[model samples]
Target: MKLGVVGKGGAGKTTVAALLAEAYVAEGRRVVAIDTDSNPNLGISMGLSLEETEAVPVLPRSMLVGVQGDVTADELIGEYGTDTPVGATLLSAIKVTEAGAGCTCGGHATVRSLLSDALADRADVTLIDMEAGLEHLSRSGGTLAHADVLLVVMEPSRKGVLTAARTLPLAEELGIPFTVGLGNKAKRPDDRRFFEDLCAEHGVPLAGVVPHDDDVVAAGRTGRCLTASSAPAVRAEIDAVIAHLDALTG
Candidate 1:
C-alpha cells in the first residue's frame, strides 16, 4: 500500500507520517519512506541523520515550465541531478545529512519521480511524507495517483479545521481516491468531538484522534520517532489510525 500524508505547515503531518512508517517497519514490512517536503525532516523523525546522496537533484528552471514533460523519467534522472558540492567552503553552505543535502529548484518533482521509479517493481508498502500542501504532488503529474490513501493531518484549532476543508477540494480534483482526516494534538474528549464534527461537516472521514503528548514534542527535539518513545496511549491512538487506513485500502 502507498500512503501520502499531507496538511498545512505545523499541523503535525510529518509526525503522523513518521509514526505510520515506524508502525509499518515494526510489522516486518519493507517500507520505503519518501520525504518530498522541502523541510526534509522525515529522516530526522525516523532517527536517521540527513545525507547528501538522498538529496534529490533539482531540475533546471526551464524544466519547470513543461519543457521537460516529453523527457523520459530515466532521461531526466540521468541528466538532471548533480552531486553534492565539494570543498570546505561549498560544504559549509551545502551541509549534507542523512535526510538529504540542501537542494535548489524543482527538487520536489525530482524526488517524486525517483520514488515512483524505485517503488515500481517492489510490492513493499510506500509512505510519502509530502509537502504541507498537495501542490507538490499536483505539480508532479499527480504523484499520488497510485496512492491507496491520502491522510490529512490536522490539529484541534479553527484554522486547522478550515485548512482541512480547503484541502478536500484539491484532493478531489487530483482523484486521490481515498482521503481521511486525522486530528492530532488532542488534549481532551471535547477536542476529539470538535474535530469529529469538523470532519463530518466537511464531508471528510475521521480516521482517528491523537492526544497531545509531551513525549511527542521531546522526540521531535531529540530527532527521534515518537513511536519509539511514546506512551501506550499514544501508541494505541496511532495504531487505531493505521488500522483505519489499512481497512480503507483493503
Candidate 2:
C-alpha cells in the first residue's frame, strides 16, 4: 500500500506516517517512507539523529528534471535513498533553502519522479509525508492518483476542518482512488465527531482519530522516536485508523 498523508502545517500528518511506517516494519514488511516536505524530518522521526540524516546528502535535484547530466530513476533512488535505522527505506526531497529559499522550482518535480518510481515497483507498503495543503503534488505536474490511499488529517478546529474540506476534492480531482479524512490531536470524543461530521458533509469517509497526548509532545522535547515514546492510547487510535485502511484493501 502506498499511503499519502497530508494536512495543515502543524498537524501531525508526519507523526502518523512515521508511526505507520514503523508499525508496518515491525510486522516484517518492507516499508519505504518518503518525506515530501521541504523541511524533511522523517528520518529523525524514524529514529535517525539530525546529524546522521544531515550527512545523507540531499537527493540530487538534477535526477528528476532531466538536466544535461540527469541521473536515471534507478540511479537516483539507489545512490541517495538510505535504509533507515527504523527498518524503512527513506528518501527526502530537497529542502527549500537548499534550492534557494524563495524558489522551489524543480524540487516538487524531483519528488514526483521518486514517487513514480517507488510506486512502479511492488512493495509491502509505502508512506508519503506531504507538505501542507493539497497544492504540492499538483504543482509538481503529477497526480497522487496512483497511491492506494490518500489521507487528509485534520485537527478539529475551524481551520483544520476547512483545510480538509478543500483538500478532499483536490485529491479526488486528481483521481486519487481512495482518499479519506483523519482527525488528529483530539482531546475528547466530540473532537473526533467534529471531523466525522465534516467528512460526512463533504462526502469523504473518516478513517479514524488520534487523540491528543502529552506524550506525543514530550517525545518532541526529549528528541525520541514517537513509535517508542507515544502513549498507548495514541498508538491504539492509529491502529484503528490502519485497520480502517486495511479493510478497504482487496
Candidate 3:
C-alpha cells in the first residue's frame, strides 16, 4: 500500500502519517515512512528522540541525481533509510541547510523519483508525509502519481478547507487512484460540519475526522510520540480511516 498524506502546515498530516505507519508496523507490516517536508519532523512524531530525529540523514540532491536508474528504490531505502523507534524505516527527501537556497525543486524531484520507482511487489506499506500546502501537488505531480491513495488533511478553518478544495482536483489531474479528505483537529460540532460541507460541496469523499484531543497537545509538550496507544479517541478515529482506506483499495 502506497499512501501520501498532504495538508497545509498545522493540519496534522504528519501526525496522521506517523500514526498510520506505527499502526501498520504493529500489525507486522514492513513499513517505510518518508518525511518529504522541507522541515522534516516525522521522525519525532514516530517516537524518535530529539537527538535521533536530528540525526536522520537528509537525502542529498546529488545522491538522487547520481543513483537514478542504477539503484532500485529498495536498495536506496536500505542504504540511506533510518529505523524509527516505532519499527518503521524513515527517510527524509530534503532539508533547508542554508539561507538563500531558493525553492526545493530538486528535492521535489527526488521525492518524485523515489515514489515513481517504489517497489510494487513487496508487502511494505509506503507512507509519505508530503510538503505543506498545494505547491507539491502543482510542482511535482509525478511524486505522488503512483500512490494508491492521497489523504488530504483539513481542519475547521477556511484555509484548511480551501487547501483541500484546491488539492483534490490536482490529485485527480495526477491520476492518483483514490483521493479522500481527512478532517483533523475538529473541535466543535460546527467544526466537523464545516469539513463535511466542504467535502460535499467539492464532490470529494470524506474519509474521517480526528477530534481535537488534549492528549495530542500533552504529547507534544512532553516530547513524546502521539500514537493511538497514547490517545484512545485518536486511535478510534485513525482506525476508521484505515478501514475506509481498506474499503477503497481492498
Model 3 residue runs over 4 Å out of place are 62-68, 121-123
State which candidate has the highest lDDT: 3
Cα lDDT tens digits for candidate 3, 110-227: 7666666455544378899998877777774567877889998887787877787787788889988898989999889788788888788877688999898998888777878987
Candidate 1 regions exceeding 4 Å error are 50-106, 111-120, 137-140
Model 1, position 93, has a per-residue lDDT of 9
For candidate 1, the lDDT comes to: 0.64
- Candidates ranked by TM-score: 3, 2, 1
Q: Give Cα distance to truth, residue 72, candidate 3, Å.
A: 2.1
How close to the true structure is residue 101 of candidate 2, measured as C-alpha lDDT?
Answer: 54
- Clashing residue pairs, candidate 2? none
CA lDDT, candidate 1, residue 18: 70
- Residue 219 error, candidate 2, Å: 0.7
